[model samples]
Target: MSAHQTSSPAAEAGDPPPVPEATRPVRARRLPPLRRGLLVPAALPIAVGLWIASLPRVNVDAMGDLGLLQVLPVTYFAALGLLAVGFLAVLREPRVRQPWAAGYVLALITVIHATPSALYPALRYAWAWKHVAVVDAMLRHDGAVPHSGTLDIYNQWPGFFQLNAAVLRVTGLHSVLGFASWYPLLANLLLVGPLLLLYRSVTTDRRLVWGGVWLYFSVSWVGQDYFSPQAFAHLLYVTVLALVLRRLADRRRAAAAGTPSARRPGAFVLVVVLIAAIVCSHQLTPLMLITTLLLLAIPRRNRRVVLPVLGVAVGLTFLWDSTVARPYVSTHLSDLIGALATPDRNATSGLAGLGSAAPGQVFASWVDRSLTATVFLLALVAVVRHRWVRRTGLPLMLLAPLVMLPSNNYGGEMIFRVYLFALPAAAFLVATLLVPPWPHRRWRAYASGLVAAVLLGGLLFGYYAKENMNRFTAEEAAATRFVTSVAPPGSRIVSVTSSLPGGELGYDTHERLVLAQDPLDQRRLLLTDPLAVLQSTMDDPRITGPTYVILTRAQEAESRLTGVFPVGTVGSVRAALDTSTLFQRLYDGPDAAVYRYIGPGARPSPPGSVQP
Candidate 1:
């Protein structure tokens, strides 16, 4: 029969003819419910158990140049591997389960971030300790810390501290130290919600959405998720952007439906409140938020939703900077101007040379660079190959922060900040590449798992490579506390480096003199005749009170890691003080020592009569 005569009745009724068997679409295979249920449920607990089993084996003292990576047991990596494999397996299923994917992401965050809290006796990172001190000062001064000296920046943008103070008051917790150790884990968990919101706004595919979230945590090696104002402000910043992006998506839908956009005053108010919170809490994040919002608004279709948020961010930032943060801005205005004047320098300032870093640290730094480049490369490929990513404006969002790189060096951290702000978009783009819109082959799952493992390795190396400098010993804490407790107000507290935990405990009461910041000649003097440098600093007429010199293991690690001083500068200086009769040994411990500079004419204390 002729082809037309052989046509089906359905075709005659204007329905399409039956597809040939060769061209028929095949249903993707899915894992059986029973198998999936058992496997996915068991994966998380096993991974958690492995991680827990691995922590005790980590000897923080014996950690080498690679930091925690050197000390972490093989089981820890096994845990990470198991999670990566399980996550990829789940994603490979024809029907991705949200709960299983989210569970794996949460597990990844916990495994990565909770390690420090579990292993370290005290909080990690000196800056976190300093922030705790800021909270203490705020509580003492009733929401305002006066005479904050170098740390006055915290007081200028006191919103974060004030919030912590209020929390302390409400919870009756003496200090943030009580929970600061776990802040990294909690902050990362808090980020997941907004990330889901942001990713969902752009795409409905669960695999892409959850894969991006997993990738985000996997490569977020910046270590900015610690207990700091930046961490808190970043959470709020992400939330604001997610809400704004959702609004943008809504506007597009409304226009498509031929309906004028509806104004949701509540949502707008919420965005303003979050923007205000972000501006008041952190300095850099507000600028980033404003830049991103302005870029989103550049598309005429998005201006109606994005412009208002951008305006609010700008106005709040201006009001806070001109009013509350005026002191810091005015004082640093020239430096900021100088940074802006030299755009090339601003762009390259954050890139530190590896000449001075330890051999292992140099390797870790290269790993970090490689990981960053890999992510950018994947995103670039996605942009070139996938029209959906470009159509959705994700590339624009990802590249928006590049404009800020030449604006200010941000104390040589602008490059890092740009990467951080660009990370969300980059993660989504990378996810599109790994988990494409169309299904292809089993090799895709293997490729995803392989890439994830590489990124995770990079994350581990990059994030933990400098833990020797970031981690503080109990002795270091105790010695710092002892000095702060005994040293009189206005006394000069000196350290070879600022890596001592609790170094800023009495920031308002004591004067700080970090020898690391000393002039080149003075640092050289410190290397040769530490006595003269200590004596001169102690005898400075402006320092009318006693002077305490603190040397810590972390300080030595920092010196060696950054080449701020000679590799054994701390040890040599400690040795000099130990043998010298001019300086009194106030307190001595294995990991740290405290020395007081008495006048040259004064006799030393009797042997074994050192103060505690």
Candidate 2:
């Protein structure tokens, strides 16, 4: 039968005739709620982070008295106003925007609370807590050193310290405890959003993202260390990677053979800015990011690869040398390296330990080796499994943890700060595994619901967990608090000949500490040479007069300085010595007894002086 002449199916056999295919219309995909809600919580974190980064102005001299930081009321009010506007703008309906909005509120609380605490140790006196006491004492007497010493203990990360001080100034908060109190909250705030973003990027399943962030922050390192710039660096590292991934996805879409739209010039600018931010903040992050670009680019066309790669590499290399590397290479190599290595049974070691091959054999041996091994295997898997990661736009699955090898498991804890970029990447892989896929048509509520359960749990555990380095022990917190109490302004204290400041029960020396001198000689200096405490103090022309010194019980024998000259002691110190041996065993008395040296006026006249 001719097609048109054929009897209708319904007429011929009681079946209805089929409708023409051309008449059927396609239904458009409904957007996912999680993706839609993402931009909501991000505003506050972005502003806070920018605020933190902007505090260190090139011309600003913030190291003096921090009277400038006391204006938190003004900032808080302004921030609150912005937050209210943002809230009202986004919160036209709570059911639609509340989850993301809630995330922002928490983030603000975390950052505002956490940064001040972290800044206290860095801004109040010097760039580091371990060396604060020594630097404070020296700075109080004189600003310059006397002898030709090989190193500058006061110099760690001047830019970073300066930035910290500026935060104190802008916030108008000066007291050390006051600043320190901001740490926990800020640390949590900075950490939470990136983690949430990471989770969202990997899986539309909110539960997985939430769970992963919770797990990530639950580790103690994320909390107590929250007060540190490293955490911010970690946040930045992840954010840049996220931005890169987003750009790459956009690039892929634009480059697709059938796409009508050309590549956005704005996209390239964003990529460059992100690369610049990572490099300006820290070296290893840019290095890791560049490595990711290279690995990811190997299969891509040259036109796509050349510019961003060059921009990131060249920009990062320049910034690394100018900001972090060149300055540190000069004065801090030996001490920094020593801190990077593990000490022996007595806890004193040499710079020889710094460059040693196996610094990870110390405290982080297991984690160092484990992370390295995992990254190595994942890198291979990344190459083999590259298509999966590529489609997902997440090469940090391998790059983040891999680059950490240079610093991980090695010397001082400071290296951890450098390696923080690895964490967000690690979190990416973890959240990806935990969350499930979300297609355009279907909303996966179970997955979304789980987001809060696991992540919040992980965050809580990470924030408060006993073993995680993020949270401080009572002793550790107490020690840091003590440092805050006594820290001086415009001082560069080098923790030398003593472990008293960084912690209460000093544990000899931490694996990451480099003493004022050879760590191996640290005990010897304390036990035999009372004057070792005075080396930085005496040798540096900066110490023209008297500076307060803290000597532990281990150094009591040398305390008298030849057992002949009467050692001047403060009343607070005398009371402390009289009160408890705990102070004697772990620390010196009167906060090790504050002393006022009247110089030649108080001590015997210099040899040339006639008796008055």
Candidate 3:
């Protein structure tokens, strides 16, 4: 050896001490089998981006997804397939790719959520149009008008409107309507942080957390994701839970460190502020918070933190409803109390009231029910089979929301809403069996990925299936606009169902009533079986008025799909209108027809206004 040369000491001494191949620096060799799995997540975003670019834009005439299925390009399905494949590929990868994989899944969710909005010229749903009107009213008046004929006491729950109005003011966005189509995408995206926080708090498994979050987005079908107060409230709900869970996790660490007294009052304060916001934002969410808190408190360890939060939730709900929204509460109180009288009846009515619905809607509804059942059932099996899921109290969280079901139909959907609330925990439980414990063999990892992909495919279908049945068209909106512009305020707006394009803001200037909404006729409405019900309601002095009787494509679809008329037919109603001299056409368009009902003793309508 040369005097200055630094040689391997073992070699110099003739001692052959070997270096392990597995322990070498990562860059010294090509990626391991597991690290190479990152290629899937790496390629996911690009494939998804290209697929989105290839899909057709939203068709403006359709209210939501109605008629959308026809125009959607093959690339739409390709995107869905790509997401499924990416999710599986990521799940199959070792820990090295999970962080990047999580990001990819979130990005995919954002794109999928915003698909309709990105594709459409106008907002997807008619209700979104009315939401803008509410914000406009709030902005112009700087306050809400109670029971404004079209908006109901939504003026009372004006926190969402207020928030949106503030955004409009700052961003100079012309209307909430334009952004409403993508509300589901954006609201869920915001929820990712809280959801991940909560899921991560309960479990150490990253795959389980990610899977549950994905499952939540997949199965959420309340349509509350549209630009509404409920969407904001849901975000608050998850965030509050996340904070609580984070606090619980902290306490666990502190106890282990012998510093259990460490405090974070700021977190509690933030939670209270959010609870107050929830109270003001929606009628039901505050109660839901209380229910969730109660569920958490049942486990003795959580009682201290949960009890105070529960009190705050109840107090805020009562305070807001009793004082600021007193009128709305009082008006709806009887209905609420009445609903509570027979819990079984209320729950059954709520569930049965969902109806098979129109054919497409029926398909969607069944898919929703099946998906929900499968999740709960899978959760049950996971809890029984896996100690990790059971000991963590995942099952308790899943059952907590069912308490809302016995209270009332909650506008004929309390049960479904409960399912929505239970979904997050349910998904976590479902993931227990699907994702294996870490440090497994490659074939096992691949198997887990394939299983997850199959489950994900089911989930994706449930998420987007509602698009076809819920959409409306721009022509319907134009006709509605003409009616509102020309017709006198407080004109009774008549429709067979509240499915018309203009009905969203009907409470603004018109006394609107859907014949199907008549308390006396719910049975017939549910069956869609009143052979001549429309004609009778129109002729009835008690129901009929000098009103604008408008029909839209959505109404026809609603009546047919829901079987809201005899044999689920809208023909009877349309035929009656065509033959009747009482209604003079006010506006006619491809998807909408507006009629001014000339009362029995009224003078003739202006000539040339009636359409054949």
Candidate 4:
């Protein structure tokens, strides 16, 4: 179409001859839509495979279904679609400003930060029920999974369980380990995306931004990195941070110009959604959100938006819990609150020595391998000196974590996920201090040392934390295997209360054995179901037949049982005991003993037979 003559720029005089038309201003060739879709499936397998491969395999069966092809396709496609949607949704915003070079570095830091718990199976016998019970309920078409009458609901955070079940429906993965581990990995990785966006919003220095990110995952003063629902809450907290900052900025600019700020409905909407997601994920998250929002409000002094935002947040939280969580919580409040207040049968005072002075214990623990304490101290110092404390609402943000210290000992406080809020704030405050227009050389060194200390502290703590749990893994594995081997196929074995001291903690794990149908036929494990046991006794007057009972010798419950023979003893399952070898598995630790039900004429008791 071009008989066009080119411009005669001083023609070929000052510059070389004009470049050929073919090479001039060439456009990138776009891939066809079909080609684009195909690339996702084709490229995905390789990436998913690589991601899966990178995961360390210790008792990988505990990881569940990584190799199971049945659900892999569903997970891959779902993750792909989600990522695509997120990308499209953010398209109108400015492109993410962080350098691509940091991807590997940030990922490495994430791995290091997550390293401690990363090695364990996603479905540990402890708390495994929280997830697997939901799976069981979905499979049963029961309204929800069934638990003893005394317990208000079958599990905690039933909503989160339902979400996990939805994944199972799409993927057709029934393995407790597979579903638990895989979703967490996916959720955790997705968590990084918002954090990156947050980093870009807060600062531009690549190193400082990443350091903040590093601290986000590294610091476990709160357990967000453990890949529980709290991890999801942490991401939401970041969004809240970004939103708060933007609102503050808008307010400040408006005030300076003597005009009203752009109080967009969209900003308010986003804050509402972020908060809903957090609450939907876990009940404890709202405390952090409310606290942070209040802190952020200090700078803006703008109630025009803040008031509405708070109202909306409160409304959504009420909606989430009221719909399902609150009803159950209300029903079970006495039980839960009671459990929290009373020291459990095997309970150690969670706060025994962890007073203000415990920082030394923390420091000593981290001296060899981790830098968490150093990182935190530096962040604390940086926060104070850099004026982040007084300048932004962050000073108040620090209080969220502080509030958790007292709660740890006040009954059920140690278990409350509310403690997680401190992690993001701590991390953010630290990064804010370190990255910057260093006012002085001494500040730079101090900031650098602070980061180093934190890094060192995290590494140390993570190492010991893992080591401390080594024997725990061995014992748990052995005990689980023994239970699986001895129990009859499809037999709903009621685990003695002693078998799971502090049932609240081990509930998740108990639920998983029921899911995996472990070799011992641990298809349905019942703990503290005295009514069920009493019913079984009534059904079989002969006290003869194939019925079996699992009991813990000399436990309070066993003593209460009046008359039940202890059939056999298996391995100890305590988390605190340390020594172990290949030949023998310890069945008891500093905590409790495990016993199997083996009396003759045993039968599962009918429901409603025994009263507490």
Candidate 5:
């Protein structure tokens, strides 16, 4: 042997020739299965235990403008920390463990999303209760809600309500309210599968895949996951995107192998079905889907597969808008066109001024803004640093929804919807910055865990900070029920805002008016002379039947937090009603009150007297 070829002890002993260090493959050190399995299992119970113990300590009634964050115990935050550390530790294992990572993600979802449902006695969001009312309308009218007034939009896009109506009938349940509070938890859980499919299709790195999933849930503080059509349609939208991307991946692999790509007729059919469902369920998601597909089709390699799906989506959306949704579309056509001309307004419409919001709410809003900016900043860094992200069209997907920002504000919620649709791609891109494809030092795990903690901290604030307004009390629900039951069809119901629970219970039969949503001049009049505004609304020629005004804690909270009315508007209005004989108190409670307006010429009644 040449002197340059140094012989090792193994070679001297007649063992196989020693492999050269430079040419040898390196294997990452993996955690033992026993250790990996025990970490998450132990952490899960501790986190869950901490959460359960903290629940009883929550004071829902005492929640201030900061919402759940103001009332949630320190133990709740401690639980989140433990879960974050456990997830990071398990994720850093050289060979990522699927079950452990998924378990931590699911546990986080439970602690964050399920806490509100558990703490609040009644359903949380007023919009969710309104959606339940839509389902009730469907059940009452035998699957058709005619003359739904402004709520006719729900009638036009009735797929979500129809599905719930069927579920209620099949299960023999009386109302969606039974399971509505849990919908956030359920909707988030349903997202896990498609998220996995999407991340895996784009990359083979397990760390990136699971990290993206964790980050998706951590920063998804947009409160759109309530029991609404948009939430359901969003699930369908993510599923369709996942399947299409998987197909793209398959075709890419087949081309590299120089093999004929097999046709996936079944998958194509499934994608079409999901797209149709999305088109029918919500008006906005379909447009989002089409924009995303058109962007995905920009690459020549992806065009063949993507253009067909895009065609179907566009056709279905056009057909739906031109037919069943025509009334709403035609009515709002000019406004939509006008919105397209003012992209700046469309983009900034959802960003209300913080000066009028409560101090705590202002802080919460800033936290949400910081969190969203951080996610996008990190994703943008990933795009600049990682070529594969752009190559895979992830950036395109992340930015495609921006196109809608210049089209229509979607009633001032277009910004949030854009964030919602863009989150999946943004999450994965951000994960690429934190979770390396190959094993590294222990400090990376700690650093990633620290980032996770900050993201979750922001998430808690963004999601629960408005619970003071979002949550409805049992008394509020009862008051709304009483008003709905006693008022005859064609009666008018007025409220400080639409935040009252069950406010839309009989929306089809009642003409509803929100003082906060009134014309600018009228809303200003409310701040000055609320009683006069109420009296005028009652005496309007259009309101031929009974007129009732509802004042509730949730409405007051919403008015204060959103600056829809001055700080003490609801209270001042209530006091005015109490002093005036023209208004008769029908139902009064600590959390809510209902008052009926007597005719202007009726004789004045004694104070504190209830009309028979």
Candidate 6:
């Protein structure tokens, strides 16, 4: 028979001929998943490096914009676009012991999120100053300070500050400032891998797990992840939740096998201790975390973890508040009770209070709401449409943080934070829309992956765009440094609001805050009706000592955008200061100004104050 002819009897009987061995297409063994997706992820580092290198070390631009989005080099967007490419490419990888593509995608997500911290010349946010001051105090005093009735919360939650002090002490960096500026980037980078561990516990689908993690980072517009106790505690919180989920899965398997409970009691104790640590470290995170844990355990009938953890949290909260935070706790107890008592009112206030403030703020509020609602809507659709019963704890976890919403206003951001806590689960559910564990057609899979990317990128853009005006500036930081260094201790420094002058510094001793919001404190100045507040503070005899009034570019932006001060009010105040002889211009930087009131009968400070 010819080479192309049938060689067997079966082929000869009206059967197709078998092709010669040499003619057959060589079977191409597919490349391993890691190497298949390796090009993009590997190039991702190069692209990020180039992007960061090309980016001019940014301080806030003249307009007081962190200028993150506006001044970002083209490479910045190119890097983000490349990351999205790598993410989509990874989705095509087959499920195996490890989805290597997911790892690549995770790395990219972190690099993108950490960019602001990496690009900035100095630490930007105002709260970070307070945190730095607290750590400075800890390093100076050798330990936590006792209560200062109405000052910073460091007196109450000193663990994070103490930890920062320890880091400074160990690194001999002099101040956490060096670390603080880059802390957000570092915190975000650290958060990525561990978050995957938590997601893995909640879902077996590798795609869903990766997508959920990606989604969480993409929509992180709340900016609560700044270098603060909340950020630190949140990292711990994710770790604790992941551990509990892992253990619960293991214990269930053991139970099914009729094996004796192995170290279940020990695990319970460990979780309780972790909860205690969280309680000590953050004011609100522990409560949110506990609510989540209890919700998880209650539905699963797993009492061991929640029972002891909740008990420990309660006792620690009470003991700590009753002793260390006594003045604060006693003063706010009734108010806390009142807020918690009318949760419906508080919930509305928390979620809707900031929406009407400014055009930019309104846009931000809508973007945030839309991002959350989109993910949640996706999750709900997945829940209703998917026929297979996913036996994950995510459903119940979604309801848990809602229970914490009644706790307090948390300065009108309580709901924002609650959504943040629920994001992992919501992201998981959103991923479920595309994450079918079983294999499917390539086109369908790729289409879903593209959809996921679009959803994520849109949310991320929303997250970044909304903060166009709020990024703190370098000049404000300089003014803060100068004031903190030059101002005589026990001197009163009044500010319109905390958004500028980085009011967080010298909060306790070197300076006293007379904010309009704090009527109880005589020194607390007002942001609104600048002239009236000024005249009142200056004319009042109690303010005999010299007082400095500050106005910074960032504060002006904040006041304008958030409507904290009326439009052009910052300039109006400054103009008033410039015209009035009563207030002497002590030191004026391009972006920040310091004025000392030399009213009649006020003793003059030594001439020539220090300048930054």
Please tell me which predicted candidate would have the highest lDDT against the true structure. Answer: 5
Question: RMSD per prediction, one decimal?
Answer: 5.9, 15.0, 9.0, 15.5, 6.9, 9.3
User: Model 6, range 409-508, lDDT digits (tens) per residue?
Assistant: 7887788788878776777677766654333455666677677666655555455553434455577667766666666655667776676535646555
lDDT of each: 0.83, 0.39, 0.66, 0.43, 0.84, 0.64
- Which residue runs does candidate 1 get wrong by more than 4 Å? 1-24, 27-38, 603-610
lDDT of 3 by residue, 1-612 (tens): 211112344223221112221221334445555457656755677667766676555443443322445455677666766776666566555452566657766766765667666765456665666676688778776777644753667777888889888998899987777667778888888888888888877754566667777666655655667777877888898889888876766665455445655688888899989998888888888887788888888877666767888888888888898898998889888998987888988676644644545556566566566776777788888777754344454577787788888887877768777876777778777766665544445676667566655555555555555554356666767777777666665466767676665464535555666776677655455345332443344554534235677877767666665555544344455555666776667776667777776745667666465433
lDDT of 4 by residue, 189-244 (tens): 66666666555444434444455665555454433343355555666776776676
Model 6 off-target regions past 4 Å?
Answer: 1-43, 46-50, 57-67, 96-103, 146-149, 264-269, 353-358, 385-390, 436-438, 466-469, 512-532, 539-544, 601-612
Estimated TM-score for each candidate? 0.93, 0.51, 0.84, 0.57, 0.93, 0.84
Off by over 4 Å in 2: 1-180, 191-203, 219-225, 254-257, 261-278, 281-283, 301-310, 319-390, 395-397, 404-410, 413-419, 436-519, 528-542, 551-592, 596-612
What is the lDDT, from 0 to 100, of the residue 372 in candidate 6?
70
Residue 289 of model 6: what lDDT?
A: 76
Pitting candidate 1 against candidate 3, the one with the higher lDDT is 1
Give the Cα-based TM-score of candidate 5 against the true structure: 0.93
Model 4's alpha-carbon lDDT is 0.43
Better of 2 and 5 by TM-score: 5
lDDT of candidate 1 at residue 519, scale 0 to 100: 90
Tell me the tens digit of each residue's lDDT in model 5 across 1-612: 311122444234222122221222447556554336677668878998999999999998888889988888899999998888788777756567788888889999999999999988899888998899999999999776876888998878988899999999999999999899899999999999999999888766677789999999999999899999999999999999999888887777666556888998999999999998888889899999999999999888888889999999999999999999999999999988888899988898888667798988888888988999899899999888864566676888898998888788888888888999999999998987887433455666668778878988999889999999999888888888888988898899999988988888888888889888789999998888888798778667876788999999988899899887888888999999988878888878889989888866776456355422
**Candidate no. 2 TM-score:** 0.51
Error of 3 at 249 (Å): 0.8
Q: In model 5, which range of ten residues has the least summed lDDT?
A: 14-23
